[model samples]
Target: MSRVILFNKPYDVLSQFTDRNSPSPRATLSDYVQVPHVYPAGRLDRDSEGLLLLTDDGRLQARIADPKFKAPKTYLVQVEGIPDDNALAALRGGVSLKDGPTRPAEVERIDDPALWPRDPPIRVRLSIPDSWLRLTIREGRNRQVRRMTAAVGHPTLRLIRWRIADWTLADIAPGRWRDA
Candidate 1:
């Protein structure tokens, strides 16, 4: 049987297990995880944090990360400004980024009570209020959420991926991992 592991990656950590010459210091999976032969299914940027799936089966990893599969990924986005209905609708309908037009997503404004605080809090403009948004997309483009939010006039201050398909970050704290 193939093994799937869910890791709640902490902020500023590289997605890869090994990095000999990273520009900045980071905590990698090799430091905390002891599972051998398992590799990450998809990559989360160094700045972004949350659920990262690792698997020993290469085929299973491809299936989960491939855009053709259309596996939904849900993100809890903290934006610099509250998104209006039109903006939210635009995200649901689809938004054009530098790469191309993205697939329509499932988006909603949410009052999330279980959000964990970041080690270094997001910068606040004070005059501009921040709001939380729940965004789900089938495509896993690079920095897609940040670009999409920026296109819609509400730049993402912080982004935490909460779920990927049937898997989630439920009860997982930063820098933790568990077998799925």
Candidate 2:
């Protein structure tokens, strides 16, 4: 049987096992996961947080990471400004990106989620209002969620991947991992 690991990837931690570019040491998967022969199924940017799946089976990893598989990835996004109906509709309909038009997304305004605080908090602007959004998309484009929100005139301030298909971040804390 294949070993599946669910990790709560913390902010500023690289998705890879090693950080070769930086002369100074940077946080990476090796710092958290000690399980041998396992590799991340997909990547989460260093600035992003929450659920990341790892597996020893190449086929299983492909199933989760490949965009053609259309695995739904959900995010709890904090944007710089309050989004209105038009903006929400644009997201639901699929916003045009530089690469191409994205697939339609399931999006809704939501209250801030109950989550652990980051070591360094996201910047706040007193004058500009912020709002939370629950967004679900099928495609795993690079930085797609962040870019989508920006295209809709609301740049994402903080992003957390809450779910991927049936798996979720429930019971997982930042920098922690568990067999799933």
Candidate 3:
């Protein structure tokens, strides 16, 4: 991507610059990014947060956003409960979704990333234990990581996209960005 910017999108913020459909004003990319003409390459759900690529080049945007490119997107996922080997295998092997079966993913259980405190913390259940997973997929499906985790009986509580293609969030803090 040319004139690319790697932004660490915060939770509850829309990927687009404008929120024309929202009845009330909500946090959007415009609130964080002021570089003119640079648009988000792909979307990070308002509920999910982390690395979002913005580029002035349209071709770069397509390459990063398109599933056909198979650009690997890695996530640090916090799930409702610890996953077992079988569940992880299911994710690694690919699961059937409403859209279709997913491509086999690279997934593994992980310890807490402890990056930033989400503005409004994810709800915690006193009895149910929570765990983390590092998952990487090539497709940019709607809520795919969350859906995949849920499909294996471990609903994701907090999802963070840490890397896309060869780019990574690295030291970028929440709501901050750097040109790449």
Candidate 4:
């Protein structure tokens, strides 16, 4: 049987088990995940927080991590400004990024989610308005959600992956993991 672990990666924690290059100790999966022989199926940037899947089975890992599988990943993003309808439409129709045009995504504006407070809260400008977005994409590019929001003129201030395919962050607290 495959050993699958669902981890709620906290901000600034590396997806991998070790950080051999850094002189100072950095938080990593090893800090939270004690399960041996399991490796992260995909990666989450150090700045981002959310659900990450790890598996002992290479094939299951590939299915979850590979963009070719088209598994949808959903994010709750807080952006610098309110995105207008045109911006939402642009995202839905697919925006041209430096890499290339992205696949059309399911995008919608949403009310602020009741989430745990970030240790170092996001910066806020008193004069500038911010808003939340629920975005689902099948592609997993490097900092794709952040880049996609920035492309539509609303830079992302905070990002959290809420769901990846059938798995979700659900009740998992930051820096915790559970067997799935």
Candidate 5:
């Protein structure tokens, strides 16, 4: 059987095992995960945090990362401003992006989730209100959640990948991993 590992990627961490191309040292999977031969199934941007899957099996990686498979990924987003109803409706209807129109997404505003604090907390703007959102998308795109929210005029302040496919961050702590 192939080994699958679920990691709660911390912010500013590179998804790979090494930092070959950069001059300055950056934290990577090697800093956290010790299991060898496993590769990340999908990528989460260095600035974003939460659930990331790794496996020694290539086919399972493809199934999780490939757009054709349509594996759903859910995010908890903290936005710069409160999104109005029109913005929510527009997101639900799919907004046009530089690449193209995105697939319609399931989105709703939510209360702030009770979770571990980010090492470097997000910026707080007392003058401008911020809000939380639960967004689920079937396709994975480069920084799609951030871009999508920006398209609707509310920039993402922080983003966390709460779930992917049937797997979730659950009890995994920052920079920690668990076998599935």
Candidate 6:
């Protein structure tokens, strides 16, 4: 049987197992995991935090990573400004980023009750308030969520991926891994 590993990756950790020459020396997967053959199904940027899937089976990895499969990945985003109906609608309808136009996503404002504190908290501007948003997308483009939010004029202050398909970051702390 194929095995899947769910990892709650912390901020500033490299998704890969090795980073021989990183300047600031952020944590890598090798620091927390011992699984030999498993590899990350998809990548989250070093700045982003949350659930990441790893698998021993190459086919399973491809299935999860392929855009054609349209696996829904959800994120809890903290933005610099509260988004209005028009901005929310634009995100749901799709926005054009620098790379290309994104597909329509499931976007909404959310009252998050289980958010964790980051090691280095996001910068605060006393005048500009921060708001949380839930963004769900089927495609896994590079830095897509951050770019999309910027396109809509609400830059992402912090981003935490909450779910990927049926899997979630429930009860898992940062830098922790569990068998799925």
Q: List where candidate 5 sits over 4 angstroms from the true fold.
A: none
Which parts of model 2 have CA positions greater than 4 angstroms off?
none
lDDT of 3 by residue, 52-82 (tens): 9999999989999999999999999999989
Q: Which residue pairs show collisions in model 5?
A: none
Q: Give the TM-score of candidate 5.
A: 0.98
* Candidate 1 lDDT, 22-139, residue by residue in tens: 6866678887678999999999988898999999999999999999999999999998888999999999999998888999999999885477788887897979999899999999
What is candidate 5's CA lDDT for residue 178? 95
Weakest lDDT window of 10 consecutive positions for candidate 6: 110-119
Assess the local accuracy of residue 140 in candidate 6 as a C-alpha lDDT between 0 and 100. 89
Tell me the spans in candidate 6 whose CA falls farther than 4 Å from its real position.
21-24
Residue by residue across 1-180, what tens digits does model 4's lDDT show? 999888999999998999998999899999998988999999999999999999999999999999999999999999998999999999999889999999999999999999999978999999999999999999999999899999999999999999999999999999888888
* Deviation from native of the Cα of residue 151 in model 1, angstroms: 0.2
Residue 176 of model 2, lDDT score: 92
Could you tell me the lDDT of residue 93 within candidate 4? 91
lDDT (Cα, tens digit) per residue for candidate 5, span 1-180:
999999999999999999999999999999999998999998999999999999999999999999899999999999999999999999999999999999999999999899889879999989999999999999988999999999999999999999999999999999899998
| Global CA lDDT computed for model 5 | 0.95
Clashes of 4: 0
Judged by whole-model lDDT over C-alpha atoms, candidate 4 comes out at 0.95
Candidate-wise lDDT, in order: 0.91, 0.96, 0.95, 0.95, 0.95, 0.92
